[model samples]
Target: MAQIVISRFAPSPTGRLHLGHAFSALAAHDAARAAGGRFLLRIEDIDTTRSRPEHVAGIFDDLAWLGLTWDEPPLFQSQRMPLYGKALSDLKALGVLYPCFCTRAEIAAEVAASGFAPHGPDGPLYPGTCRALTPDDRAARLSRDAHSWRLDVDAALALTGPLVWHEGDRAIPADPRIHGDVVLARKDLGTSYHLSVTVDDAAQGITDVVRGVDLFDATHVHRLLQALLNLPTPLYHHHPLLTAPDGARLAKRHGAPSLASMRAEGVDPVTLVADLRARR
Candidate 1:
């Protein structure tokens, strides 16, 4: 018997959905539907500061307009804080998580002074300033300064043996250090993207992750998290991103037209879906 594919389209409720967002959502929806499997919708609204109720409504509205529906009611990240807290606690107990006291300015300054800034998927790699903190030093900083928790990737890799993840037919070696010591939880948010995404994907029984190519590198970190937490690793599908006419990736930051705007302008949902499928 073949494995039943369970996929998801998780979007943050920070802005309106765009053509690029439609592309990804449709890909995941179609993938599961084509396989007679299940597709899920997860509202990644952990960043409460920017996650507005209107944007969440717009996401559901736009996805409906695109003729996309999930297998069940959507899962909201805001309602699942305790699960994240538990995952963080588990990682902390594993002794692979450490407090990161370096601010953005301090990290940038240190990387600049070294004059050899190696970039990661998120940007300039975090210089392991806090990773090397002595127990007394870390304790002193923790007494007063607010700090984020980072995974000591080197330490984590040592705990696991010869890890690899699948994307379609390829078996890519897991190299979590490509992202350096990634933050597991934030002082304010109580969780970071890497941790929440890994935890939620497992909790929802997501058998496949269908997203953009931009997140391809982030999978390395996710695979490590899966191993550390003893969660099942899902097959990943990093599809190409829809691009603008000038060859730039279609994005809200680049003024991409939103699906809601198109819907208001009298665009037919069936016609748009057909067009998207044809282009695929």
Candidate 2:
């Protein structure tokens, strides 16, 4: 019996989907199509402050315009707060999560004062300042202070032992501490990307995770989260990003033009999809 390949393309509704997003969505869709399997769509609108209702509607419209469809209705992260909360509670019971009350400025100052702080994929890692808080102190702070919840990576690894994740048949060693004490829940949102995405993948029974190379390193953290949460890790494909002629990767922050804007300019979705497939 052949194994059914399931892939997903998750996009945040913070902005419109760009060429880079198009390439990723098409890649996942085509992979599932080629395998005669399931392709899922996930709306990663976890950042409530930034996510907009209009952008969510735009996601459906743009994918429809591109003639892309999914095996099931999309999963929305905003509605799954309790699932994430339960995962947090599970980790809390495992004694691997801690309350982090340090603000960004305080963390930066501590790192700067250290003269030689360790760096990760996203600059200086958290220095574990709050990890050393006493129980009574933590409780007192928890009473009045707005704080994020961070995974104690060292403690988590001790519980899971050494770990690895898969990309195709390749078994990449997982560095659980790569992102050092990554936030599992933000002060404002009860869930972070790593925690929510890890939980959702299992919920959707996603078999293959297809995403851009920019997140390749983050997979190490995701792999760790999967282990801690006792969820299955999916096979991964981190595709190279589509970049501008000047060599910058296409991104919303860089003001990359979106598929909706392109369509408004009379760009043919069929032609664009064909071009994207050729590039793939």
For model 1, which pairs clash?
A: none
TM-score of each: 0.98, 0.98
Question: Where in model 1 is the C-alpha error above 4 Å?
Answer: none
Error of 1 at 175 (Å): 1.1
After best superposition, candidate 2 residue 88: deviation in angstroms?
A: 0.2
- Residues 1-280 of candidate 1: C-alpha lDDT, one tens digit per residue: 9889999999999999999999999999999999999999999999999999999999999998888889889999999999999999999999999998888888889999999988887788998999888999999999899999999998899899779999998999998888998889987898999999999999999998999999999999999999999999999999998997799999999999999899999999999888887777
- Tens digits of per-residue lDDT, candidate 2, 1-280, equal 9778999989999888889999999999998999999999999998989999999999999999999999899999999999999999999999999999999999999999999988998999999999999999999999999999999999988989989899888999999676889999999999999999999999999889988889999999999989988899899998889888899988888989999999999999999999988876
lDDT of 2: 0.92
Q: Would you list the clashing residue pairs of candidate 2? A: none
